[model samples]
Target: MRILHTADWHIGRRLHGFDLTKEQNHAFEQIEQIALDEHVDGIIMAGDLYDRSMPSEAAVAQLNQMLQQLNLVDKVPLYAISGNHDSAIRLSTGTPWFKSTQFYMYTRLEQAFKPVELPDTQLFLLPYFEPFAAQQYFNDDSLQHLEQAIVPIVAKMKTLFDPNKKHLLVAHFFVAGSATTDSETQLKVGGLAAVPAGLLKDFDYVALGHLHGKNALHAKNARYSGSPLKFSLSETKQEKGVFIVDTEPFKITFKPLTPLKNVQQLTEYFETLEDKDFYKDLQLDNYFGITLKDRKPIPNVMARLREIYPNIIALNRADGYETNVEGSGESGKQIRQKDPIELLSDFYKQVAKDDLSPQQIKWAQEALKIAAKRESK
Candidate 1:
């Protein structure tokens, strides 16, 4: 069975103040084409079907239309789950009847235990869950953190594994070593905080979500399908796509999806930016993160620049000329300031002489919070 693995649709997502309806629709077109061309057995959507927990009515309508096209029109089996950004109870609607059309959607932790058995594979559709929920499900109060809570779940899932068929664990969580971008919200405490990759070794293929980049985690058996769209400027270079996984031989391949308007970055002086010839032939419609090298602020600089590049998301001053308001001028996240994460990252690079690890970043964030509380007291 060759299934298409995709995740983190973020259906209602917006870039800066621009509605991503056009861009998102274009991405879906490519995905539809891929499904048709490949003649995939099934499509697995890991999680984050919506941009927010309570999605807009239009967003809901759009997703409905997309599902109708993919499952109903194309006649393909879809296996999906709700991520941290989704309301599981809300998404659980119509799930009981979804299986009639071969649409398998799992939201609750309890539902994950039951596998969707196929001819060549068994899929464990695990949705994003809080550590507390896992603790309650297993009746183990001792399972306080994600790493601890998932231990029993892994052990139980392994017991159900059949040597006759290949097993795929479809889940959404911050797998411990996976890199993250600014776009993803940190489910710090209650949710699946950080799951170790070692626990997921028994499965033939671990289809993961949460992180926007597919290459975020590089484990042998596990691979993140990533997001179909670039939600942040940090993901400009990331190749967005769906993974085609074969169960019999156990092979996975990433096929790229081209976005309507890709995220981009431009670093230049104020004078050069105003030059008509310099900006000519460029995809000005693409989301841009611009950096200014000019030492002095130009009058009506943003107002003028907007005429040329209307899709600028972030603007930064490399010269350290601070803006009165961070995100008020022209672009959101304007004149980008070094936050705790970046500051700590720089500090670690200087002191330890190596980039800070994800664990170290967590420690720094916690330490900063403790210090802030102390100062306030």
Candidate 2:
């Protein structure tokens, strides 16, 4: 059986306060195309179907439409679960109706342990679990870690799973081998996070989620499909893709899912802009994120860069420019020509057209001094 493994759709997710509905819709189009081209038997969405537990109305409409397009329009069986960002009850609603459409939504662990059986394999769907929830489900208080929580769940599943049939496990959790980027929101508190790969050794193939980068984890049979769209500037250089698992003999392959647009972050020194050849080579129309490094401020850097790169998202200085010096030591280092707090106070004063009071000025100076001390230490 040919199955497409994809996760972390994060529908309704935004980038720098800009809505990503269009990008997400385009991704769905690619997913549909893949289903048709590969003749996939099933599409497994590991988790994090939406960006938040309480998604916007537009997000809900888009999600409903996407599901309809995939399950009804294309007739591909889809199985999905809720992640830390999803409201389990909300995603699990209309469960009975969805089954008729060949879409399985697993949100609660206590529902049932029946495996979704295909001609070639049996899938064991384990949604994102909390420690308390797992403990309650199994009535086992000893389930302290996430890896330990899976022991009972998997043991229960073993009763229903046929040893002769190829076993597939779908989950949403931080696994040991996975590498998380700065953009991924932390899900667990303390060191009680992450399930070990050894916990899933019994399954023939494991499809994972939660991590936003493709190849976040490394296991013989486990993998993360990653987010469909780049959600953060930190992910500007990541290559996103989906996983394809061939279960007749049990093999997995990753297929690249193309995005509508590319995200790039380029840094350039403004002092070197005298060379037209350097600026000519930069094609900024493609969602450019440029950083200008200059000792002297250019009057209209935004306007100037826009002439070449129209879609500039942000512009910032990379130089060691200090705006405040709270708690700075009286070291013999080059004294700042301008008081850092005074600069900040001046900036706010200009914006508000009001001068800082004596108390405010003193507070700012103290804050800057504290910052300086921390830096020196």
TM-score per candidate, chains pooled:
0.83, 0.81
Worst 10 residues of 1 by lDDT: 326-335
Indicate the TM-score of model 2. Answer: 0.81
Candidate with best lDDT: 1
lDDT of 2 at 328: 46
1-377 per-residue lDDT for model 1 (tens digits): 89899999999988888899888889999998998899999899999999898999989999999998999999999999999889999899999998999999999998889999998788999999888898899998998887888899989888888889889999998888887665544433325578889999889899998888888888988988888988888788799999998876778889999889889889999889889888887888878899999766465667778898988898888786644433234332532465878866754565455998889888988999999999999
Question: Residue-wise lDDT of candidate 2 within 307-347, one digit each (tens)?
Answer: 76677777787784444333343332434465677566655
Off by over 4 Å in 2: 185-192, 271-283, 303-307, 322-377
State model 1's lDDT.
Answer: 0.86
Model 2 Cα displacement at 100 (Å)?
Answer: 1.3
RMSD of each: 13.6, 7.0
